[model samples]
Target: MAKEIERKFLVRSDEWRTRAVSSAKLMQAYITVNEDRNVRVRLIDGTSARLTIKVGKSAMVRDEFEYEIPVQDAEELTSSAIGIVIEKVRHRVPIAGKTFEIDVYEGFYSGLVVAEVELESEEDHFERPSWLGEEVTGDRRYSNMMLATNDLASELIHGVSHQAL
Candidate 1:
């Protein structure tokens, strides 16, 4: 199993932009947006079909298996995916002797910036780059999977509502 252990954080400033290489813009939308549907057809590195269920706040139960579906069938399945859309560009930069990915969102999440660092293990250690701000790992609100399903404008509204209250 390929374990994807990583830490997320808020970018302190835009200085990291100087180190950016290029960015890939993408917009992915889930079919339903707020449901817990777990069936997914992921085209990562290679083509694969799998079913994953959220196990916890930051964990998922994934089972990748063989697939024999045709392209049309595959598209149909993916089209039914709950609002899993993410529209953004990923900025790659080297920081602290390691590569950090900064995601600049667009569309509904136009002003949000998130950074992530992948690790070999959950216990991995690393230097904190000056540009990295507070760690947001385990913060549900910062999770891209959640953001894909949420209304970006609603988040801003609630943020201001909290201050007013």
Candidate 2:
């Protein structure tokens, strides 16, 4: 069992773009979603795929089980997904000796950008980049699961302007 601990923040500026070391285009879909657990399949760069099962209620910590699978299998899973597929470009940025993943959303939720940094434990400490905006770590509305399951973009940020950079 892998314990996933991470902090999430909204992107305030594009400064992180200059520091991005690598990036990947990802498409993900939720196969099953419950209050405490969820199953997700993600395709990376249209070349690789992974199936992840996460269980827990904590906003910053969860039991995660991920396995690589054939791209074809993941593609098939999308048809059975509970909601719309999510599309984004995730950039890896190294800052203050830690790596952060900046996800710039696409498709239905285009222009939405968020950054996340994985930590070793809930008590771990890290630096917050200037490009990072408000910390949305515990905000359920900023969660991928909620964003995928919910239909109203207005609920996330009124008027959908948050969808723009």
Candidate 3:
């Protein structure tokens, strides 16, 4: 099983935009979300699709299993997803030998922008770009799974502040 170790942050500025090497539109939905595991289906650029299963309890690391699937199947699964489908454009920006995935959200999450960097190890150190905002690595509210299932208004009303950074 492959392990994924990553850190998440809110975007502070648009400086990373011009430095991005590429961007792709993505739509993903969770088929199942539980405390221990989650099953997700993602359609990328309306052409490629993947089915991903993530297991583990830690926010910083998880055992991830991902496989390519037929676009038709992904589309079907997305339609029957449990909650809101995630829509975003992912921009790939490279800095200091690491790549950061900046997601510009769309649909109900239009104004949210988040950046994530994968690390080889949980203790690995990485450069923090000036555009990176507050670290939200362990914040469940910023997790894509939670973002997909909960109402954004409730999140804000309940005091989960998305502060300007």
Candidate 4:
């Protein structure tokens, strides 16, 4: 069994932008591999794909399992998804000695910027950048999987102009 433990935080400022290296801009289609539990696959950088399975009894510690798969397989599974499509550009930024993934969303939910940090363990401590805001680690709305099912741009943030610098 693979366990993925990580902490999520909101971006606090645009400082991280200048430091971020543009990774890739890709269109992703997702489906509910297990909607009841929160398991899904994300295809990034065109051909690279990852299957993320999150399981946990509480919000603090979640067992996340990520596996690499073929993008074609992942695309085929998108048909199994309940509904909705998500689009975003992934950026890699090094902050606080850790690599943070900053997702700048587009398409239906544009102007939404979300930053996520994966930890070795749930209790692992990390340097929180000033640009990081409220912690939405446990919020399902911020989860990439749920983001596919719910158009939460309006729900996560009212209206903001999100762009990569």
Candidate 5:
């Protein structure tokens, strides 16, 4: 099984922009989202797409399976997604041998920026950049599945600040 282990954080500054190696426009939506698992369809750069299934009850780790799918199918799935579709620009910033995915949200989630880094293991060590803010690794409100289902107001009430930067 494929295990995904990552840490999440709110972006506090724009310093990461300077170090960004590349960026991709991403649109994703959940097909099914529940406490136990999530099924997501993601289109990247309007060219490629992926269908991902993640299962597990833990916030820090999950069993992930991803498959490349036709962009047309992905687009169709996105339009029929369960709730709000997620729109964001992901910038790949490499720092201290680790690449951080800094996502700047758009649309209904404008002004929210998050940074995430996948680790080799749960115990892997990594350096935190100055632009990274409070750790939200285990915060369910920050989870993409929850973000797709809830609005800004609901997220704020759950401790996700609009003034994150």
Candidate 6:
């Protein structure tokens, strides 16, 4: 199992765009979810796909099992997903040596943008970009799982974000 460790943040402005080196459209959905784990499938740029199983309860670390699956299989899984299929364009920006994947959501979750930096360990150092707003690493509300499964419109309609962080 891969030990996944990362931190999440809200994007404050468009400054990160100037630094982004690459971007890819992503379509992902969950097949199963629980307090401790989730099974998900992702279609990247509609050409490749991956099935991922994330286990563990730590806020910054998890046991991640990921596999490359046929796009057809991924499409089948997505068709029967438990909630809304997540649509986003992931922008990769290298800041101070660490690459941050900034996810700009579309569809029902439009207007939401988040940046994540994967780390080798929970205590590893990562430089925060000026465009980074607030750290939302442990906040479940900003989680992709919650965004897919919850009725967030009511919670977020007051403004651009419920976690407008």
Total clashing pairs for each candidate: 13, 0, 0, 5, 0, 0
Indicate which candidate wins on lDDT: 3
lDDT of 5 at 66: 99
Q: lDDT of candidate 1 vs native?
A: 0.59
Q: What stretches of model 5 exceed 4 Å from their correct place?
A: 157-165
TM-score of each: 0.66, 0.94, 0.93, 0.80, 0.93, 0.93
lDDT, candidate 4, equals 0.70
By TM-score, is 1 or 6 better? Answer: 6
lDDT (tens digit, per residue) of candidate 6 on 47-129: 99999999988768999999999999999999999978999999999988899999988888787888999998888997777
Instruction: Please report, in order, the local distance difference test score of every candidate based on alpha carbons.
Output: 0.59, 0.88, 0.89, 0.70, 0.88, 0.87
Which one wins on TM-score?
Answer: 2
Q: Write model 1 residue lDDT over 63-160, tens digit each, in one string.
A: 22333445455456567756655556778887666678897766767667778887766777888877787787867677666776556556632333
Query: Tens digits of per-residue lDDT for model 4 on 1-165?
Result: 766566676665677878886678756555543644666766776778877777765544666677888888888766576556667888888876888888877787676777888777767888887777778888867776667776676777674544232
Q: Which stretches in model 4 have alpha-carbon errors above 4 Å?
A: 26-28, 33-36, 162-165
Candidate 3: list runs displaced more than 4 Å: 153-165
**Model 6: lowest-lDDT 10 consecutive positions:** 156-165
The TM-score between candidate 5 and the true structure equals 0.93
Model 6 lDDT at residue 133? 82
For candidate 1, the per-residue lDDT at 150 reads 59
Q: How accurate is candidate 5 locally (lDDT)?
A: 0.88
Instruction: Report each candidate's C-alpha RMSD, comma-separated, in the order given.
Output: 6.3, 1.6, 2.6, 2.7, 2.2, 2.3
Which is better, 2 or 6, measured by lDDT? 2
